[model samples]
Target: MTTLVAIALVSCDGPTDAGAPDAERFEPSLTGSAHVPYSTSETVALLDEHTACTIDTYETKIDCVDSSGATVGRFGDKGEGPGEFLSPARVIRGPDGLIGFSDSSRRRFFVFTREGELVAEVPLHMLSIFVPISFSETTVLGAYTDGVGRAFFSAYMGDVMAAAEISLSTGDVVREWKPASVPEFPECEHGLPYYGFPAVGGAGDDTWVFMGCGPGGDTTMLRAPRYVAESPSDRDVEEYGDGLREFRRRIGADPDVSASVREFSETPRLYFLLRGQETFDGQGRLWISTRRGRMESSFIDVYDGVELVGTVEVRDRMIDFDLFDGTLAVLVERQVGPDDSDGVPDRGIDWYDLGEF
Candidate 1:
């Protein structure tokens, strides 16, 4: 039997009419200028106390900025070179203080020091691209897909994906583990045109993975599961396979139509949703963006380990966000006028002062 844990939900509706509430709401502290245009598909990571790095998908480089919001340095280019990136997927600060990035097009992973020096580049030819979680002198940790095609759709059916530790030198998998499961809605269909995938991040030896979907009162109890990576025996993997098979059976999806629908969901189209990106802070707190109502406002659920700490509803539609030190930075998108302009709207990055929430 599966046990569901009830998490207490706290709503911080940012300063009501009562002349500012006791809780501090998220307010814009910094905005990205034209020099460092924020990309809706890019991933941001804090390099240190004063610098934050983002994979500029449009510019095809890593943009590093200081606390003053000035472009300190930009590295990499659009080419098939050592430091260059072709179709860079995500950028993350590894556990070794080095910056690691994955390029799905090139089927390779690159590691660079904070000083913009490329140290290692390894070719990884896998069915699904794995997001780097952490790194050491010899190995790199990441969340990888074990099965192909329909297996990637397991998250939609409430199954825990696979993660592994790979050798940085030989490009070989060292060890793998499957985390615990969270609440999943097997009947939920893809209402939006484009859907968001599950994200994985690491802090020290611990790794966290989560999947988010739009707000629905009927599925309010659906929260992303966080698990500590552990070594498992052959029986463990076999049991997980059984659970996954059962989940797929419960969804009652035709195998052929399921593959077709998954392909269609990848088409580039305007998609609006209540849930956005998920990440972990330096303090190991899980921050997940979600919407509660049909309004434009969105809320972020902050969890310390597995316990729900607090929730804050922001006024803007959060596309993605990252936490560094005590500050919260978000990439937001707003609807623009002129119906002839298609679905492309104005987007920007906003830094927030998360004061004592």
Candidate 2:
């Protein structure tokens, strides 16, 4: 038997008041012009070119870093191993100092002790799942009716994100909820439009807010409607999915959009609008990597809710970003200076502190 609980959200103590300017709360200037010292001699290195995994490629295991840039811990390589990871989708630290990450491509969840010891692995139900990046320390007494499940015992999945509770002692999924298949966003059905990521939020309360993005992608700029699925129940979800499919068919059948729609459909990434990358702090904040601005240069935007607030700049094209423990960590590629004797990239990890912003 399953029971659904309705959840209500209280505004975060985040900077969202009338007197508080968005700039004051989320300052882009903190990252601009000024270059903060992120790496130091005391920084620890975890997984690098020498860590014995397939490290020749750029986007391979080069993505993981500690939240504070103080050290890099051991997350295994591409092959099968106790701590191994193949295309890690997301990583987070639970309250108990256990590090958890989901391998979307591998359909597994990994848990490790604070010292980088792998102790638990949980198999998942689907391969297309995008694992939720947030962690709650408390136990989940109920699954909220809203898109975001309520209670501390819950975790989320992506794209078709779901909220579920897994037993910490047994690694078993206690209760689960999945998004019923709705039609793809309508605008993409019509034009050769692109879509990236939908915005999502999880408050301290059980309220999870979700809004879809329409016809926006790595290159095109389009004003998209923001349709939200507030704290919806199982019955409400069924109805929403029906409405979504009808909208998709309507746009797909349009004669004017037939050609572009066909092309867009051919490229799954562009047509499906999988932003390719998504990040959330589990604290009601989200960031998406989208090509909606410049095709050649991908620009990342940060949001508190449905509102567009700021941008994350990767000036060197040699870095990526991740949200960790309420902070944003930037993985800057280790570069060799002209005077260095060894040609290998400098092995150092650094992360930006967003809380200070």
Candidate 3:
């Protein structure tokens, strides 16, 4: 079952009075950044202590680099031929040492080995907004966040859904995943929305979390609530958002969001607000970039499925962060203006030594 966990969050030993989650705040020491050819490295798979693979979507190539920032290898070409990619937008590591890459522009998905060997490729004409987190030679398994707004624009669907196993040949979702925790966007009905994602955590924009990593792309467990009822879930509503808010308040999140210059949550338009990202560690511990805190530095809440066991504070408003072999790689926004030189990269990846938990 998909779950918005209901677990007690205890504060870390030393920061009990900090108004943050009592979860232990693990300190991080800055390390050297991995050298990437471009600033478009978003999806990364940490291979080892000094080696990791990042997708340079700008050039449609996969780059593997070491701790010292030297390019160990580069693979993929921009073309329609075999082993070539038109626009590699997203990458996620799959089972059995395989990785999934989505070419958004060409409406194609590819599975490849770390060495850039093409394993499986599928042409999905309707694969516009659906990101393939797990796929095989046939099935395109993943989440589609746009489904939230689709039902609003088209005929309303009769059921609520978390994910879909889509087939371009059939032009429909052949199979689907349904979880009780998935938020419901009803059209005067009590059923679920057609293409909604889990939107509980104020953690960030990450839509879904994977269920269990196995041979097949089965990410039913990982989810973000894409849409909820017009009014926020009541205090008694114990869904994913409820659990996440409980955790946020414990971690020093200043509720009562300040009024903004533009449209706020009180508006009638569709809005899903969350900052930061979520990722799992080798030992199955879930680490999330904590937002809504009053501190200048960001905090990463480490969860053991059910409870807040630990937390890691970052030094900036991170774009994204990943951990590999006790090392943390944080993607930060670069300061660039119209007159900025080319040397001032648009993005920066900062490395850190993850302290003891």
Candidate 4:
């Protein structure tokens, strides 16, 4: 059985005073603790008041840690069997004390109990990437995409690529909704070929969809009509492309500076600034992290539904985060040492109290 739900349109023009207040500063109460030595980990989720879950991308497993930073138990391995994962992309905790794991490589969804017991395994088709927005004993709601495609870079910017409601018992998609047509910009040569999909987060019965490309590339909580403003003049785009090439060269990513510059120059002005990850707090506030500039920390935008609440700045680069019980669990990259040989930097999970906010 399949059903389609019309995408609900909401206002995106929030109040002018939505910026973070000067008096409000969110400092990490705990920093760089040697307890959780990060490796190829990308995400952190708070399971309970004292328990934190960290996903190890390299190990392909999830680590459960207590408040004292002690490893309580570990679940998952690299396999095709139950409780195993091939490419674990996202891990989310459900309201019923079940942990949902979306494995893009295997194209399957695995559910586990809080105590690390394998409960359910469902094979998913169509969507290559899955981010669970809401889950129950029988149903799972989330936003998904068929990976990167030209249609994803449409100009409308308001449409979600795809969304679904899956049945846990039958491993079937009970409902699916997709955009009718993706608007395109014929003049712009650059199409978002990478992961340019919108960010989706949900709490309780509410789900929040955040499109990456808005006016000025600012993060917007609701999907509004595509901005039809004038594209950056060709000369301006070229200048900005040159700057981007230089930055890439300095970072040692682009060795052929000339080719990089040419590539960027031919591309369209997709976004003024890149938006990062987003998560919904326990109190139903949507927190989105947007990069200020190259190699800069993230400014988190808080929203109550489509209304802008305020912003919070984090000093470190936020890879991914999770919120539980009014606590913000942030996974941040550790600073590299001069003597560090390996290119991969260590990561740590920092906790912040969002109770007062």
Considering every candidate listed, which one attains the maximal lDDT?
4
Whole-model lDDT for model 3 versus the true structure? 0.49
RMSD of each: 11.6, 13.7, 12.3, 8.0
Residue 231 of model 2 has an lDDT of: 34
**Number of the top-ranking candidate, with TM-score as the measure:** 4
CA shift of 309, model 1, Å: 3.1
Q: Among all windows of ten consecutive residues in candidate 4, which has the lowest summed lDDT? A: 2-11
Pairing residues by index, what is the TM-score of model 3?
0.57
Q: lDDT, candidate 1, residue 117?
A: 87
Q: Where does model 3 exceed 4 Å of error?
A: 1-17, 37-41, 95-97, 125-128, 134-141, 146-161, 164-175, 181-276, 290-298, 315-317, 334-346
Residue 237 of model 1: what lDDT?
Answer: 35
Using lDDT as the measure, name the better of candidate 1 and candidate 3.
1
For candidate 2, write residues 241-307 as lDDT tens digits.
4333433443364334345334333432221112224555555555654323222122455555555
lDDT of each: 0.52, 0.37, 0.49, 0.54
Q: What is the Å distance of residue 277 in model 4 from its true position?
A: 2.8
Model 1 backbone overlap count: 0
Task: List the candidates' TM-scores in order.
Answer: 0.61, 0.48, 0.57, 0.67
In candidate 4, which residue pairs get closer than 3 Å at backbone N, Cα or C atoms, i.e. clash?
none
Per-residue CA lDDT of candidate 3, range 1-357, in tens? Answer: 243322222211112224334557677887766546554334565555555567776576887666676776789989988767776755655656566767755667777777778877667545234555445445666654444233222211322224566553443567655343433222422222223333223221133332211111222222211122343222112222333343345346654323421222332211111211355576766665533231235566666654556667666445456666688876554444576676453444567887575
Candidate 3, position 215, lDDT: 17
Off by over 4 Å in 4: 1-28, 31-41, 147-159, 179-276, 293-297, 305-307, 338-343
lDDT of 1: 0.52
Per-residue lDDT over 1-357 for candidate 4, one digit per residue giving the tens place of the 0 to 100 score: 222221232223322232323324454444323245554445566776566777765576777776666776677779987768877655777766567877766878888876678888888866456666657889877776555322222322223446677998887889866543332212222333212233344433222243432232223324322212224444435444544554455346654556645554554434213222566665666665543321235456566665555666654656666677766676666555675688545566666666577
